[model samples]
Target: MQDVRVIPPYPEANEDGIREGKSKSSKFSFNFNLKPKEVKAHLDKYVIKQDDAKKTLAIAICDHYNHVAECIKREREQGDSKSDSDEEYTKQNVLLIGPTGVGKTYLIKTLAKLIGVPFVKADATKFSETGYVGGNVEDIIRDLVTEAEGNVDVAKYGMVFIDEIDKIASAANLIGKDVSGRGVQTGLL
Candidate 1:
């Protein structure tokens, strides 16, 4: 197993936006040292075919975790002071589209396990716009927290796989508003 360096809790800003002492809550961060090739190599062992998808996912995973490590490093160095450099950081979001039976879920699950992070999978069709009516998008985050054993900080780095996203697409020919489709999309955003 690869060694993972776990970051301990640091002083965080309070409700008044002031960092006075060590916060009770821990923000989970880690050292991501694996290269893209290393990740792809591991995937190749379990997943067959879909070289393009594997390569893309490997690169994306490496980039994302590296960026997270950098951010954690910056936070540690800066202490309580906020940095303007954060604004320059671009967020990376990946949307994987493929036919059924593809190893999309398996690939992601493997990567998450390899990196020792939380992973959650949800069906888009089950979620509705309103929380009272159906599954709320925020439930995904909550599920991540649960996977992290109630550690919100660790959950922050968790991966959520929302399957059947295409099912939520609004049909053009619909007479009225597609609550489950468009509403779910908006909620996800």
Candidate 2:
């Protein structure tokens, strides 16, 4: 007589249902090799008209990401050692201002998708100053961290879309001061 064991058909996974101990966020790899023209072409597939916005966003995004990649490469080449005096390039954050339904958000979302990075879209109106009921501006960074599965490195490069940014401005006709609005603006700065 012989004894035999049978294996389950389904793949084994961790308690969180992630197989192979890999974070789900790790699935998408950043495409640091993307060119500006290539990005615009990809955007064309999802976005309708708005050639000017697409072109501008594509160029700026590509330039920023390329700088990030270059920094990483330089650090690796230097054996992760800082030089006595090294000039570091600051990340240029782009602000998209336009009327509603103008695809300001859609543009960044499409770019994030094309770049294979995590994207977090939040509304500026939803945040308040610290010690308030609503969320704070830094909460956006925490959201990014969560979206990246607690990977700070990935979250650092993730795109955050803050909609309704103009709503943070203080109202002129208000009888009393606008605490939330004005406070949020200051916190963001």
Candidate 3:
């Protein structure tokens, strides 16, 4: 396994968590202590403008990782046999809407890098509901696995960012079936 440099939980810490010339390795361990403001500040260095989008994404990302950390701690304390019924955690999913060239991709990609998590980016136009000509929805999971170096555990906590999601909107004027648009959307759900 590649050694992942863990970042300190403070906003003023460096990328590699080096403080006073000390370094720590956090391999296969989730040490998420990032606040929403810290995340937004990190994005501000790379992505220009889009303050609202950055803030929204920062909150969602922090919520998701914080929940994951809590669940991991809980599982460690209790046995793994405790099923999902024991606790309920609503997934923090966000839908970002904006015009083209608004730094959407850069924002997400940068955030994923800062958190040391796998990220899979796919264009909606290349996918279809059926597994005939276009890519399947399951491809996203497969790509995540690849991004995590074939580690399923890491992929589970990964983020899948789909671009051009609006392209999948089903048009009422279309006859017969709308496999690419409506079908893809349904398959995602």
Clashes per candidate, residues 3 or more apart or on different chains: 0, 0, 0
How well does candidate 3 match the true structure in TM-score terms?
A: 0.78
TM-score of each: 0.79, 0.74, 0.78
Per-residue accuracy of model 1 over 4-72 as CA lDDT, tens digit each = 322222223323211122322654445567788878888888899989988998989888888777777
Q: Using lDDT as the measure, name the better of candidate 1 and candidate 3.
A: 1
Q: Which residue pairs clash within candidate 2?
A: none
lDDT of 3 by residue, 49-111 (tens): 899999999998888787767676677888563456447767778888888887778788787
Pull out the clashing pairs in model 3.
none
**TM-score of the candidate numbered 1?**
0.79
- How does each model score on lDDT? 0.74, 0.69, 0.73
Which predicted model would earn the best lDDT? Answer: 1
Candidate 3's C-alpha runs over 4 A off are: 1-27, 80-88, 171-175
True-structure RMSD, every candidate? 7.1, 10.7, 6.7
- Per residue, candidate 2 scores C-alpha lDDT tens digits across 1-189 of 121111111113322211112354443223266677877887887889989888889889878888766655667677653443336655567788778898988899877766555689999999987887888899988988887677765667778998888778787676765657988888877
Better of 1 and 3 by TM-score: 1
